[model samples]
Target: MKKLLTAILIFISLFFFAQSRPEIGGNFIKSLFTDHNAEKAHTYFDSFVGSQISVNDLKELYPQIQGQMGNFKSILEVNNEKDTYYFYSDFEKSKLDIQITFNAENKIIGFYFIPHKTFDKADDKTALKIKSDDIELKGTLLQPTQGDQKKLVIFVHGSGPQDRDETIGENKPFKDIAEYLLKNGISSYRYDKRTYSNPETFNNQSTVEQETIIDAVNVAKYFKANESFKGYQIIILGHSQGAYVMPKIAEKAQVSKYIFMAGNARPLQEILIDQFEYIHKIEPSKISVEDIQNIKKQVEFLNSKKFSLDSPTSELPMGLSATYWKYLLDYKPLEAVKSIKTPMLFVQGGRDYQVTEKDFNLWKNQLKSNKSAEFKLYPSLNHLFIKGSGTPSPKDYEGKGNVDEIFLKDLVQFILK
Candidate 1:
């Protein structure tokens, strides 16, 4: 998806103005995607947006999403909330929630594609809320129909503003994992990240602690205090970014065990550089040499003393503020893991470029002295723990794929054992 994928996490810095006309907003969105016209779409973007995103970026992103969701049908409805226009659009394969943020001049400044809200509740699933102080997060709890609810897996989201399902394009990895676990008599809970459920509180100055750990700690505490789950083992499972913060969550909560699914042991700044390099190697056309150098410069600047809380967010990678980078830079994941005595499992997908074998190896090697640490590696799976062949690129995240059965079996065994 070119730089668009890179810019997916980029924080918008502009002060937005409201637009009352859905027809005008609808027409702009139609022209942008109807023919997959990147050039035409680029014309609508705010001038400041040109630096971080390019027409080529839009060109690369459209096809990747379309490949997953199929061709766009039409905007079924539109809702304008202040500065953002939310379009409920129909695609061949699914309905999508399309959002566009406008500048004071009514030019497009931010664009995002989110899955339409669908609480696919069955008899085994029940809706719930996890309360943490003033913030309340909506969540889902799945209980096995035939077994004792003596154990519950608390799912912590990887990164970004993810829904409870952890929906990525057409794939819902968290939902798939939870549903499969229920079939095996395991209970689980998954919730929307604070950034997703309450963005105003999250703001742009959030750290990994505020973004992930606190909510996770609260979820664990909430369940641990519940009378129904008395004597039950509360296990926390972290995927991707969740893995990075798992140890801290475990330290603050009364969890029996923790899981690392494609977790990273390195700092996020380093991982960002590694990911950009990996993408550039596999799909050179999508990420240019200049793009690589630019990212490196941002990372380097972030590491330098010149970076302070007052530094411009626009100059930083992903437009994240200095506070966010500083928190991650100071976070020693290895040190964090070593401090926790709780039994842990490290699961890695060999094909996952985002959190590669290099990261898994770090966890295994460093924790080798800890008998409480266990490991599993699946050679054919991608970041989502889904199987794939050939070189895995950003394209792997597109389309439909379920978490591998073998991996799930092993996960269930670990939880039960």
Candidate 2:
């Protein structure tokens, strides 16, 4: 459900300047949005920048930036690497890294807003590839070195272009889960999402079948065919959006079990609206009423059955095509679950704003007749199954944390039992 924001704006002089003050940088950024006062902002620019870049230059640039990132909200975090400081600024739409260096007078001498990157670690894992047709995704297979491996978990990522670790800010929940499972003698296989690896292959027309399901089915088949993995029970673990589509994947892939992590029983459109409303309630300024109305109009169109292939993608919610929405409209998770005979473990974070307790309850209620269906509720955890307290927001994900230990212990029990 997370989207990546990218920007690269750099203006640096050949010579190095003095240490930059975070307050100056923060205020200057605030000025850009407050009044768009290029003339005033120019005064904070160092001599080198002032000479080369005029007020008109900033005027032209500020509008372009606001068009993409919306109004600047606040500076979330600042990291210093020697003379350079990277300010993780939160905008209305997304977060960006503002790299700046100040002159001796504390004026802005060098500045940049580059793409954010958080490095992944996988020393204990073996690199592999999961291929299907033209798509070949880079992946990792981790096996416990100490104990007998009788099972392998295949991780399916949530919506968006996710890397192998399902990285969010500094957190790598999948990697953390993989390592924890490895310690307990459980092997895991995770790969970059198709949209992440081969973005060119997808467009607005692409549905979940193309973006997620096929690749996951292929991964299960790949492992099942391997001689080494012959007798091991293959468990498919789907997170968030992945969890919503787990039943479809389970139908195609002959996995022994399914693990739905923060999965939703409600339709995606409903869940999306709920997420926006929750964000607006907690932080009224972050999501505007106009935004909610716009999304609702799109949701109404999808439910109305008036849209066809001719419908514009721009008018659709999340810019997904009419075909994509149609697919979701036709397929119901609850109905899909009825056909899934494979044992399922539905887990949800009590504090998860994205997929809340309502969705979990829907799953529990709908699947109550099924003896094989199990459920877990981590009351203190967030969407990522990471521990946190108080009101949950996007800021909650910024802090570094791992999946709850208790959930992992229970997962092991479910798998081994």
Q: Can you write out model 2's per-residue Cα lDDT over 198-243, one digit (the tens) per residue?
A: 7899887788999999999999999999998989999999999999
**How many pairs collide in each candidate, listed in order?**
0, 0
Q: Can you tell me which runs of candidate 2 are displaced by over 4 Å?
A: 1-125
lDDT (Cα, tens digit) per residue for candidate 1, span 150-260? 789999998888889888766888999999888888889999888876778875577888889999999999999899888889999999999988878877885899999
Candidate 1 lDDT score at position 41:
73
Alpha-carbon lDDT, every model: 0.84, 0.84
Cα RMSD to native, each candidate? 10.1, 10.1
Model 1 CA deviation exceeding 4 Å by range: 1-70, 73-95, 99-112, 118-125
